[model samples]
Target chain A: MSANVKQKRTLLEWVRGYTGQKYITTVLFLLIPIVLLTLFTLIPAVNMVIFSFQERDQLGVNPKWIGLDNYVTLFTDPTYLSTFKNCIYYFFGSFIQLALALLIATILCSKIKFGNLFKGILFFPYMMNGVAVSLIFRRFFQKGDGITNSEGTLNTILALFGLDPVKWLSTPGLVNVCLVFASIWRYIGFDIIMFIGAIQSISPDVYEAADLDGANGWQRFWYIVFPSIRSIVALQLVLAIKGAASVFEIPYIITGGRNDTSTFVIKTIDTAFVYKKVGLGSAMAIVLLLIILIITGIQKLCFRERK
Target chain B: MAENKHYFDLKDYTFKETPKSVRILFQVLKYAFLVVCCLVVIIPLIIVLFGSLKTHDEYIQSNVFALPAVPQFSNYVTAFNQGNVLRGLFNTMIILVISCFGTIITGTMTAFVVQRFNMMFTKVVKAIFLIVALLPSISMQVTVFQIVNKLGLYDNMAAPIIMYIGTDIIAIQIFIQFLDNISVSLDESAILDGCSYPRVYWSIILPMLRPAIATVLVIKFVGIYNDFYTAQLYMPSPKNAVVSTALYTFVGPYGAKWEIIFAGIIICIIPTLVIFLALQKSIYSNLVSGSVKE
Candidate 1:
């Protein structure tokens, strides 16, 4: 009891004498997140880099050092090559997503009645779970038993127009489009919300000034609003590229990456878990990471050059 | 004499100069566009709601967009039992509460130190965080899963909670931005009054941080609640299933029954929808400001 009391008193004196209360508290405050970040993100990132270079069995046991072999296979394999190609479709899809969002954001930001109501309704989908969205859209896009017996909502609509029901999820050509459409449905609102936020940040006085100059709606958007939110657009572009390349959950749940809908991330998950090619999966992940980094870098360069 | 008697009104002059027909046409077009977009957004959700209310036979027989003749509320009862939705909700709530609190505490504390201190270590810490923020976390999942497994946290609630709290860069950014707006005089004055650092934080700063706290809490709550990928990966067991995973598995046995699946989806989404409706204004404003400043 005496030793414990003495140690406590000495510790108190040490805190008071050398570091001061402010410094000690700062240390205490920063400790948790710093530690957690290191353990979760930083260390894992390094481990991932190392794992990519080493070969491991399906169960991720008995690692053998094989330098660049995984990466070689990733580049040469036709299946993996197609997965990379699929990312291009998503990249294009993101463009549509951004355009649609921008259109909605600009229109909503204008002097319109029930703008808040419209915003609320449109942004609601952004909060839904990915799994729920997949199910809903799957039902919406499901193929019917026959042309006359259309089951999916889209096919029913097509039938209402007297057109033959299209194979929404079955055809190889249309399946990726269907999945991308689902993605657009699920995430367009999020982009709209972000774009709306960016648009709202522009001062109204600028719009009024442009209005006085007889700059029509399109001119005003091009000159004042678009330029002001260019940084956000660039940021969103980077995010779009990243999101497209890493597109998972939707395709994974909706099609299980079948019908040529497999993306880079889905393929990686399949490799690691299903095929038990841990090293190869890690390599694919690294390749995807590098692709994202390079794209973001290129985007940065383009933005800088335009400036 | 009548023209002289009535002063020319600005509204009347504008309406007379520009054809009201054109203006009305523009108004109609604008509303038409908005309504079309609104329909596009709402129709799918409506279909799901209507589909959920239909009996299995009705769902299979009727058109996809057709309304139910008699709404079958029993589907929800069946969904609740078969989907294990109550258990899912209970488990998800445990994750949501713990992770939200954990994120707020860690994010605020770290932001406080990083924003307040001028020490070299703090700068290094900030730089490290920024770098990690830019890195694609999806790429590191292989190692992350291994790490979780090695830590013996797999198949436990703690796995997702830890991941959620540890990986949140947005909350940290928001807190730091909030701290920048708060004057340091409050801290200095409290210190002068013999308040310890921790005491100053609790008494002077925390209450002042109410708005930021609310924003972070709401964002994190929605994020953790809706997350399926992490939950699916870490918690593989059915007994420990959260809402998304539970719904995924529930679909297996009831694969042919779209009504039951729709019911489960509705149940899964209702809580978020209700909370969103109740807090629309604050949530919208907070989200706007959060994205803008970032």
Candidate 2:
């Protein structure tokens, strides 16, 4: 109790030390955002959960208590269910992408030639903002453009050896796949950069010790490099899961959830903004939030400190 | 068998004079893989450039990945004149500058109190702001729109800018981490020298916050300026539209003016994109330093 009073007095002394208009600075500093966020962000966020518990009538004015019926409907809703499957597709496939990203990071961080130049180019897609990536990819995906035709970039070149011309973003299954691939391409370089830093953090003495023990490259990597960067890989895994959940921009831009390719985010936006079904949208949002919470919990369990 | 390779890489142990066949194969594979990755990333950008130069029909029928036949530069002029992309550019600039300024002032001030001052209220405030990063805005979609309408800030430049500053909690959280490392000595010195708390921040602390300041400005400028969602959702009117929205409409019913849309995209990307490319080094360097410090 005496200590509390003593700390308070010193704080007051500091305050009193300021010459003119005491406490005015504190007031000014905290004013704008405090006021704005209180009303704009906090209130609305609270209201969103409340709205989800109610049902609105046709005229868009009347809202009645629904008692979790909307969540029940969302679970049974075919479109929503389909979206979960698609997101699962995106999530698993992206792990394969992380391996590619790790490979790139390894090479870039290695004593190989022109590694900096390679790193810069690999990171190029990531630096350009999301909007450009969307628009440019939209052009790239246009069917008539034939750029995506059998002799087009993917068709005539990379996958040219056999498989059919993947409609890219045109078909429902392929659309989700294509969007996931694009998302991977766009953002995986960031993981590469992060991984390079993690790899660099491993002490040279450890590797030297491994070399002195006559450990081969694979053995050294398994014993040293992999273990050292587990924290980073854990971080990347969390990021990847979050990416799967909140991947709104790509789906929104490319298909706008067209031909049943929409994710939960797209459905929520449509319900709220377009259909004037704010209550339904709120319910969907809550469902998504719950799912994410579960996922986050599981991720924490999976990536917990294993030392 | 071992007396061959001469080169020592960044890891810095010397090798023999000549490389082995297996080493040569791995090097070849590494460069080839990197080249392919670079091309895939760069192709979208290349296509955007080429697509911008073609006629609308040409963009449709011909190869999007192909070089333009005539290299029509008129698409840009047409896009600027027809789309009111110029107006969109001007409107976005206003929001970008004002919102960034508002964000900095509010964020720095809020963060300062939240981090430095020991009030009970500030603790609650910090907790709320910390969680703000987790709460996705898309979850609050309907309420935000309704609230904006209630506030009478709907569809105006004020709407997007307000949202920008209002949701700017996480960046400030990051800023506070940096501010934590910064010594409070100058603030104390200024206070003792008869400066008020605000005055001390203005004169003493804000100057010392140059690294943090640069990091914030460059990062925020690129992010908010390049944002599509907030602008797409809130400010839908062409008169009040940002470049992203303008480009969206340009591809719509009255005009799928592909050439113009393409041109507008190029124009829209220029200011922030050029700044991005030029300051790429500095921005990455600052981010590296900040990330390292954190």
Best by TM-score: 1
Tens-digit lDDT string for candidate 1 (A187-227): 88778888877776677667567657766655666787788
Give per-residue CA lDDT, model 1, range B31-129, as digits (tens).
888799888778878888998999877887889888899999999999998788878988999999999889988888888888877788888888887
> lDDT for each of the candidates?
0.82, 0.71
TM-score of chain B of each: 0.92, 0.87
Tens digits of per-residue lDDT, candidate 2, A147-185, equal 422133454343446665556767767777777777887
Looking at model 1 chain B, report the run of 10 residues with the lowest lDDT sum.
Answer: B4-13
**Cα deviation of A176 in candidate 2 (Å)?**
1.3
What is the TM-score of candidate 1?
A: 0.91
In Å, residue B271's CA in model 2 sits off its true spot by 3.1
Candidate 2: lDDT of A38? 81
- What's the TM-score of each model vs. the native? 0.91, 0.86
Q: Model 2: how far is B149 from its true place, Å?
A: 0.7
Candidate 2: how close is chain B to the reference, as a TM-score?
Answer: 0.87
